[model samples]
Target chain A: MLETVATGHQAKVSAERGAERSLLSQVPLLSELPVQDLTRIEQQCRYRRFTADELIVDRDSPSTDLLFLVRGQVRIVNYSMSGREITYEELTSGAFLGEISAIDGAPRSTGVMAIEDSLVLALPRSVFLDLCTRYPNLALKVMQRLAAMVRAAQDRILDLSTLAAQSRVQAELLRQAQAHRNRPNAAIIEPIPVHSDIASRVSTTRETVARVLNDLARKGILERCKGALVIHDMRRLQSMVSDVRG
Target chain B: MLETVATGHQAKVSAERGAERSLLSQVPLLSELPVQDLTRIEQQCRYRRFTADELIVDRDSPSTDLLFLVRGQVRIVNYSMSGREITYEELTSGAFLGEISAIDGAPRSTGVMAIEDSLVLALPRSVFLDLCTRYPNLALKVMQRLAAMVRAAQDRILDLSTLAAQSRVQAELLRQAQAHRNRPNAAIIEPIPVHSDIASRVSTTRETVARVLNDLARKGILERCKGALVIHDMRRLQSMVSDVRG
Candidate 1:
């Protein structure tokens, strides 16, 4: 059954039934569902793959599917009226997209693109909503996720509005570090997008980001290794943000 | 029944039963509920009044109730690490507050304060969630409201990131204008919250907001009345934002 369902692109083959079910179980909202319910959900999902830079959803287009990344990473962004891209967020595997539009049936407000070769399980909006309605816990989980997103956005707004340019860069770096933190007291953010990408995300110029990173490296707070940026002093970085915010 | 529910100072007396029901009917989330359901919801609510500058909800406090403003206005804001106030949003009559916390059971992330003598109907969070679970349409309506808020926040992020200081001010003004626009081609933003308040909302300095408003006035695009700023040329204001955005 698994092989039959796996189609195209041997580069990133679809997961077998057991693997897919395990993947679904890893999702916070679906984690506690009974096996029967998980199977039902798995039946509704279709696996799809995208190469780097592939557009998954276009802003303002009808949002018809909920996408759960199973492999690789993606970027969520919006283009300004002048065509400047503003990165709203980035998602890695185990993260889902399109909850806002899926709940309200609104057109997509941001464009999502694969940052690397990615695999995702796509569930139609109707099926997702049905699942939420049928499972009260699912509805609560969805609401919790949305609430957390709202709080994160509010914090971003605060940072953009009040923090200075250097502070903004540090703040974003710290945020990314925390998200990817694996060590108890340190964080390694790999393939650190690009200075330009970081600038856009923090509403600063690329030069500013470059200058800030260089300063941090000189101060022994951060180090650049191969394809990643490592934060050596998380406490110092946090204090810097607090000072700027103050 | 209405009289019994009205407590504390009654400079603005509690609304009559018929009037209370009518007001609930006006709320988008409760508008379509059956009369019996509406009455049940109404029964669970109690009227409260806040004097100008009263704190409605404290930041980081446990969220205990959902508030529906029946009269006057409130501002949602967060205090920076330095004690600088940053306005996140403002709500007026017909708007409800605390749905985010009510849904997620998280602490209130921002403080809400009354800008004037205000009347509100308060519903306990547990009851509100119960209502949502029992009424699917009610739950959908709540979800729709949250979705709209998420989209608005995304737009704000875009504006703050890409627009110039002056453009940011103009964009926020245009947004507020549209929300309050009563006539086809005009909008009257009354008691235009102080310049500093507007500055915080748009992430600009008070001096910048004053300068932008002065420029608009000099260009005949806006006129200041006793307690309001009247947009004489809505199209012109709209175009100003579009031009900056573009």
Candidate 2:
């Protein structure tokens, strides 16, 4: 009976390891890593769960463990001194977080809140650094990701400094459409972006987002379908964005 | 004699090498590299010069050589499709540029314009990547720099999205004062910031910047001295910023 119990326990542990390995395979940085290498790092990590609307990482926290989002979604956000919340970006499954603080040992730039029930694989800072040092490609991938963030941020800053409110709304739609690529010269924002979510992205109010959508719909640029917003006049819409971006 | 000519040539070459070494020493990323390592990289780089107001790196250029600013200043800028100019940031001597493109092999995010007669040391993208791969500390520094940029940009985005025009001005002054820390509870903005520069930073008009300064002076929050702007009440100024940030 004791021998059978030992075998059953081994099977359970092996099943958990198999599940962990599958999640690790989803991370773009670790995707190219060999199976054994992925197994080695995942073994050094622990799994954690957070429920919807729960804080995953505190902004002022000093801990800096790199986290891999294996399932569900989370958003990077911060509250103004006045307690107004600002959402920076959202991450879905297969994405990762905490690399900035992990690399520099600084407090997080913003807090992370789970938008849905999330399962994360957390790797200690030391182990993550060692992994980067061992894999040049991993380091390059991280650098590229950081560079893209900088580029996106700069574009936003420029837009905020120059574009009018209407143009800003148009520019934001084009941005969203580009992110959700479609056929040649045509695009659709799938999952139907909420007015408040688009408001945050464009640094405006939900009312303004609704107004802009109405204007676009009337102009035959875009229209809301059952579950998506279809952008039809890609050329005209792009011209509107460039009108102020110019 | 041929031997005498060779000796003179060697002296001239050593003098150039000495100057290059001193400049490389100033780069924060390369400062920790050994003298021989610095010399090796410098030997592989070529020096380039630009006149004041000249374009150093075109925004659409395909080249991605990492550049070290050995002398003078350059501003990262972009023109809107309609010809409106946006100044992103400025880099002075000892600072570096082009790492974003070098890491991602992407197009330049913005053009670099020489603000004064300048000298730059250009290293091939491959050499820079090789150096980063070989030096873990160097990679860490680059990552840290990129992270800092993201943090700063996010702060700007939040301010633009929420703060009133006057509050943005107050917040900007607080930001600049913190950057140029002086005695506790007081700070001096030396060389007195130009209204246009502050305008760009706060995403307001030059008139707005001037009006805000005048209002602050009337309230005894800050005063204009002969060559600088002095903040006499840092706490009050900070409180005003937090009023909106809050």
Candidate 3:
């Protein structure tokens, strides 16, 4: 069902400017901004909420807002001609979205949907432009964040275009394993997401993921623990990643 | 046969700082930089030359430089285990390469090759860091550029993962036609490299490109003009793009 909300929704978005400044201080992009600038940015920011499955922004629409996720999860997705949905990337707290379109005054390339109840700090394009006009440092920090994201996408493109289904799954698992290793004192192995969600990211089907995971488990490379695959041999998995980008 | 010359030939790099500043002035990423800052950046630039088929940068190497195309073309490519090469994008004048890795201090994600005898302005990572420190405006512009690139890649990912071979080819042809429309009015469509090049970019076999072009020719959708495919029906071709991306 399509629901249209009034633009007055903007009025309801209250900014706790002091709180926002402190919160944004923890974010790399905003943290780089001097305290005075951060406070000015926070004063112009507004908070908004989205329920699960609601469209945060529609694809191809003129984007006028920048979103900084404060809570919950989101999925970047698009629809195919067959009416089949393609999930591209998942976003969580601290992630920024829609910045390019907002910055350039262009239409958005993909749609955003909340995967869970989401709270976001939404900044208007006008305010963002004002900040850019006032502070070059803020712009540089934004670019640094964008550059890092683009690099990640480059790695992902290499994997998707070159790797086999099995290798793609393995490499993704290794990526998650490495990410988990950064968390303190936890078992280095991560609780892998459901096979379906994993399939969405790899552009494969759940059946294929299940089959591959089962095979890996049989080989004693990964084990089922608490219904999640726990990687036991990272070297074996790392060897598989090169093949993905070969 | 490998041509053995000095590891680096007379490099033929044109580091004309004034000309670079002018050229960069036209590009959005550097357009906003003050004239003085632009001149400073130009001083830190160096030019490099590469012969056709030369690997300018290999996959997985540390990224220490960013390339600005002054003249000629380069191909951004990835390879599969079975030795199949896929051309992701072609870079011509005004295009920048490796900025993502350069900014992120990460390894190169794809191999860059000189598609023709090419001249490029190479900016070392240290210079980039200096620019970031000296001019935040330039940094923001770089970030916006990176964000746009990421969006472009996301679009490509959707295309490659979801579209069929023939549809992808047709959409690519339409894109090319749009791009060439701005070129000086000419009787002949420009000569593209080969069917294989087109196939690699769209992630299909060369045979498929040949077959599809022939089919389109037979259908009066496209015609051969001076050995180049001249699109005869743009409306029908646009519909194909919509259908593929729908």
Candidate 4:
């Protein structure tokens, strides 16, 4: 009976390790890490589960760990003195948060809250720094990821500064289409969350999102089927984004 | 005379080395490298000089080198099919440009041009990777810098998405004040660049910039004295930005 219990414990540990590896595999920054390195990294990670609306990272708090989203979604938000809370971005699986603060050795600038029930793997800064020092490839990958995020932010700035409202909505739809296109059997239809989530991405209100989406539907460019946003004419939407940019 | 010439040659070489050290000093990314490593890294640097309006980077071209704005200024611009050119940012001394492509080994997404006679120190991919590998602290600094740039981009996005035209201008002024504060300033009266440059940073037209500046002057928030812009009331300008955000 003692031997059997020991075996069961080992099996459970193995399963947990497997889950950690799977999560690491999904993160683009960690995708290139060797299996041994990943296992070591997994060992350094602290796993925590969060319920909906739970604050994962608080503004002004010292950031000691890098949080990687394993399942569900997280929202990055900024609250102003006027009591306006702006949702900057929605982060899903395969995304990491708090890296900037961890790297800078600074306090968190914004709050990160779970949008739904979620699991996160938090890697301590000491371990991350050690890995970065030992593995140059990992450092390069992190830099690349950060640079890409910067580019995405630049694109957002361009949209907000120059693109028209209709065009902004269309550009977002195209982004959704491309994201969903990567999955298996992606051609049939894509699942988008709520209009509110979409609104947060584009920095518009949900009412504006609904109005523009309805306009697109009326124009025969898109359709709502089975509670999913379906693109009937991708070319038209592309043109709209281009027009707004121009 | 021969001795003088020999001494001058040695001086010139010493000066070159000194300039390299200064450049290395300003860039936290290269600070932790040893002398020999820095010499090797400097060897990989391609020094290029550009006259006013010369294109350092063309949009859509594969980005091959990271340009360090060692001296003078450069402008980042995005051109559209409708022949509209929007100036995104101006990079001055000690600022880095063209890092997006260099970091990702990807194509240049925006055009960069010398707005003034400029000297740029460029590092290729191999040298960048080498530095990252040899010095982990340098890698951390690079990541931190990239993160800061990303944060700046996010701020720009927020301003564009949420703020109106007038507020965008005011926010930009506040940013300028902050940047000036970071620099070694001799006095409160700083020579403001051309209105066009300010317009670019704020995502407005030159005429609009002029109009706004004139209005602010009338409001006693700022004053133009001997071709210099003096902020008479920082509180008022900040309040203007806050009002716009609201």
The prediction achieving the highest lDDT against the true structure is 2
**Residue-wise lDDT of candidate 4 within B123-177, one digit each (tens)?**
8876776667777787777888887876777667666666767777777777677
CAPRI category for model 3: acceptable
**Tens-digit lDDT track for model 3 on A134-238?**
666666567666766666666666666667778888877777777765433222454557888787787777888899889877877778897555777766767
**Alpha-carbon DockQ of candidate 2:** 0.55
Model 1 CA deviation exceeding 4 Å by range:
A1-26, A32-47, A179-193, A226-228, B1-28, B31-48, B177-194, B225-230
Clashes counted in candidate 1 amount to: 0
Q: Candidate 1 overall Cα lDDT vs. reference?
A: 0.79
Docking class of 4: acceptable
C-alpha TM-score for every candidate: 0.83, 0.89, 0.84, 0.82
Q: How far is candidate 2 from the true structure (C-alpha RMSD, Å)?
A: 5.8
Question: What tens-digit string does per-residue lDDT give for candidate 4 at A66-140?
Answer: 888878898997665554456767889888888887787778767888889887878898888787777788788
lDDT by residue for model 2 (A1-246), tens: 001123444445448657545568888878889988888887677667678988888887887889899888999887766666777789999998988888888888788989998878888999999888888778888899899888988888788777877788898788888887687677889889998887777777789889999999999989899999999888898988766776
Q: What TM-score, to 2 decimals, does candidate 1 have?
A: 0.83
TM-score of chain A of 2: 0.87
Model 4 — interface RMS deviation?
Answer: 2.5
Clashing pairs in 4: none
Q: 3 or 4, which is superior by DockQ?
A: 3
Between candidates 2 and 4, the DockQ winner: 2
Taking chain A by itself, what TM-score does each prediction score? 0.83, 0.87, 0.81, 0.79
- Local accuracy of candidate 3 as per-residue lDDT tens digits, B122-186: 77887876666665566656666676787888877778767877888887787887776643331
- Which digits, one per residue and each the tens of the lDDT, describe model 1 over residues A1-246? 111225454214423433444456656678768978876776677777788988888888885687788788999998887778888878888788888888888899788989998877778899988877777667777777777778878888888777788998998898889988888668999886599899878877899999999999999999999998899988899889888775
Q: Which numbered prediction scores highest in DockQ against the true structure?
A: 2
